[model samples]
Target: MRMIVMIIFLVLLGLLAILNRHFLTYPHTLNLGFAEYKDMPVGLMLLAASLIPMLVFYFWASVTKLRAQADTAKLLRDMESLRTSLDSQEGSRFQQLQAHLDRQFAEMQTQALPSSGSASEVASLAAKMDAMKRDLDLQLDQMDDYLKRKLG
Candidate 1:
């Protein structure tokens, strides 16, 4: 695509140069500076026209390169933000898992101990522990859903 555009631009430049030469040779009713100089050769006009377009193209090329650099910088910034968010979420998930495991271990210890009081108290504690574990699992699942949504 770039090559095709370049070819088209070169053809246009060639045409402009030809037109400049023809105009320079012809008598100018409304002569702009160089047009009044009949003694001056037609080649100079053609050269000036051709060089002007090339200079303009050079400036435009530089502008496009700078814009591309800016775009690259913005992409890098966005990537960095994503990476930071991922790292933070991972840390939070690890802490949550650790806390859940610790709570489960504590519950197991309570279950391991000998029953000293009435059966009702022990059964109540066990039931509450089970409910707490279930709630924690639900919370973890919700966290997973939130993370998936954030990533997508």
Candidate 2:
């Protein structure tokens, strides 16, 4: 496809250049403060005028393309680093939460347990432990929901 377009453009350019041949031999001159060109062809003069800007634009486009690609690569690297840090932070938060839950369960056992020898006291302590276990389960479910919401 690209070659076809280029070929078509070349044919058009050949026609244009040929059509301009009558003007090509027309005498022209260009002068600078320190240098001078005399009896240059009109075609050569026209070619120079058109070519300089195209060269400039090509270089400018190439530079900008490279800069944009470099910036995109840097952005991707920064995002990957940020993602890893966030994952570590999330892991630490979960570990801390689990440790805290363990401590709470230990405290419930040590503090709510009755020293009485009565069966009633034992039963009451058992019920309290069961409730604490359910509370822990509820907290875990809430944490799972929070993570899903955050990630999704």
Candidate 3:
């Protein structure tokens, strides 16, 4: 879009210059504080002055756009790295929790097999596991919400 606009502006400026060729080429005097320029094509000089700034601005905008794209790409790479690290950490934590739960169940089975209250003990353990599951799910949901908020 910017390119199109720039091209149109250049074409219009070219047409105007072409239509006013005689005026643009006509000689005149230019004065500065310390020097004077005689027989100068003042119109052409003004045209060059206008074009220089426009060209500088166009290049500046292109460089700024490229910098912005590079920054966005860097941000996405950082986000992806962070997400992968978080996933790995979560996986390790889950593995640790599973190991702990397995150990606890093994201990419970060994102790309960010789007791009469084994059924009640199993039910209590099941309830505790269910509670832990709910807590884990809540934590996961909170983490998900946090990630969504950050990304958005």
Candidate 4:
């Protein structure tokens, strides 16, 4: 839409220039040695035309730079908050893990203890194993003697 407006303005300017071509072609004769004060020179008009665009562009760039700096500062604050939160969460997790390890260590200590009268129980278990071994030896001897007699 802005391009359309600029195109229309340029077309009107061109038409006006064409219509005033005869007037622009006629040169004016000026009298010499006339004191002309407060007159604008052609160079000043050209300088104004050139410098206005540059000034506008400079102002635009500065405004955009300021906006970008503000955005960067806001993001940095957000990042700092996020970093602090993460550090706190990690610290809590480490503490939780340490507590869990301690609990597991305490549980392992409970499991390591055997029943009461452990030495007496071990002696009784050894006597039972010896009795079973003697019964197995007697059975093997009876089987050997029975087999030898049957073969004879």
Candidate 5:
């Protein structure tokens, strides 16, 4: 949109200059505190003065946009690295929890087997634990998927 506006402005300026060619070319004297100029095309000088700033601003805007893009790219890369680190940490924690649960199940099986009533109770508890673990795993998977979708 800015580019289109700039183009339109340039076209209009060109048309104006073309329409007033004789006036733009007409020479006049210019005076400054320190120096004086003779036979200067003041209209053309004014036109060039206006154009120089516009050109400078356009290039400055372009450079600023490029810098912003580079910064964004760097931030994205940092985020990706952080996500990867967190995923590895989560995986290690999951493995540790599984190991702890397995050890506890083993201890429970050995101690509960000696009594018949407690054996049945242990089986029921094991079933419940398995169901809970499955639910927890499903929830974690859903959360990971949600995070991936949002970030990517």
Candidate 6:
């Protein structure tokens, strides 16, 4: 929207310049290191001078826009790559944690379920199993919360 308004304003300015072309009347001349010119109008000269800066501004704007687009594209690609890497890493880590948890539970079962011939021994073993289960649940809940925060 801003670009459209700017373009409209530039067109009006150019029209104004063209309409005021007769502001210069006397003969005018210009010379350069490599060339020479004569009979140039002051109004026309003013218009050309104004157009030179506008042209330069347009070229600079285009170059800057292209650079910005390239940067954005590069950033998007990097983001996608990072996302995929994180996903793969997350899956592998979850699997590793699950396997580790299963091993720990199996070890706990083998140690807790045996040699419970007496009532007191059975009670102690039951208490130990409950503590291990609570610990495992706490760790799992912490892991879940960490993953939710990280992913979000």
Instruction: Identify the leading candidate in terms of lDDT.
Output: 5
lDDT of each: 0.70, 0.70, 0.89, 0.61, 0.91, 0.72
Given candidate 2, what's the lDDT at residue 35?
83
Ranking 1 against 4 by lDDT, winner: 1
Quote each prediction's TM-score.
0.48, 0.53, 0.63, 0.45, 0.74, 0.56
Q: How do the residues 1-152 of candidate 6 rate in per-residue lDDT, one tens digit apiece?
A: 44676698789987886676567444577766687778867666766778788778777888899899999879777766786677679768877976886787667667666555654565676678678867977886787677556644
In model 3, how large is the Cα lDDT of residue 10? Answer: 96
Q: List the residue pairs that clash in candidate 4.
A: none
Tell me, what's the RMSD of every candidate? 7.5, 7.8, 4.8, 28.5, 3.1, 6.6
Which digits, one per residue and each the tens of the lDDT, describe model 5 over residues 70-151?
9988988888789889989998998999999999999999999899999999999999999999999999889889877876
Top-TM-score structure, candidate number: 5
lDDT of 3 by residue, 1-152 (tens): 77998999999999999999999999999998799999999999999999998899899999999999999989977997888799889889988998998898888878787776996788788789979988998998898788867764
The reply for model 4, stretches above 4 Å from the true place, is 1-39, 113-152
Q: How big is the RMSD of model 6?
A: 6.6
Give candidate 2's error at residue 49 in angstroms. Answer: 3.0
Q: Model 6: which residue pairs collide?
A: none
Model 1, residue 89: displacement in angstroms? Answer: 2.7
Candidate 3 lDDT trough over 10 residues, lowest sum? 143-152
The Cα error of candidate 6 at residue 139, in Å, is 16
Candidate 1 positional error at 57, Å:
1.3
Q: Which 10 consecutive residues of model 5 have the lowest summed lDDT?
A: 143-152
lDDT of 1 by residue, 12-58 (tens): 97787677766556543445776555455556555667778776887
Worst 10 residues of 6 by lDDT: 114-123
Q: After superposing candidate 5, which stretches have Cα over 4 Å from the reference? A: 29-40, 114-124
